[model samples]
Target: MSYRQKQLVMQYAEINNVLDFRLKPELKEALNNIHKQLRKLDDDRERIYLEYSQKLA
Candidate 1:
């Protein structure tokens, strides 16, 4: 869970503190951004590893 989720849960533990509808779009955007960043990182890591491996081969 994100920091926002933790804060919400701490403030409203009952009923699992359902998310407010208004934040849904923002949450989706944040998730999309994270996925894009992670994908880029993975691609870069793989490319760098291959580059080094080829050099040592």
Candidate 2:
């Protein structure tokens, strides 16, 4: 696999481990919310990058 793909896989594993750790319900909910927001931001970044790359081509 490509270096970028490997890095993303590792990052996802780390996030999963963090979510698995024992924590209160409120804190867990907050963390899950943050994760959701981060995923959305990543999606946005990928979309912008794709647009820029297409424009360059």
Candidate 3:
């Protein structure tokens, strides 16, 4: 994942731990959005790696 994405993940984890079973609505929404971005970044990285490996083969 990208640097910003990594940071967001860390923040999300920290917030989750701190909030435990009581999370605010806005924070939950933000976490969901970050998760979406992280998924997209992961997909993009996988696609690029696949293309690179195919070129080598």
Which whole-number lDDT from 0 to 100 does residue 9 have in model 2? 57
lDDT of 1: 0.59
Superposed model 3: Cα runs more than 4 Å off: 20-23
TM-score: which candidate is best? 3
What's each prediction's clash count? 0, 0, 0
| TM-score, structure 1 vs. true | 0.59
Candidate 3 lDDT by residue in tens digits, 1-57: 578777978887876775554546677777788789888888899999999999999
Tens digits of per-residue lDDT for model 1 on 1-57? 245445444543432344673655565555555556556666777899899999999
Query: Can you rank all candidates by TM-score, best first?
Result: 3, 1, 2
Off by over 4 Å in 1: 1-22
Model 2 CA deviation exceeding 4 Å by range:
1-23
TM-score of each: 0.59, 0.57, 0.72
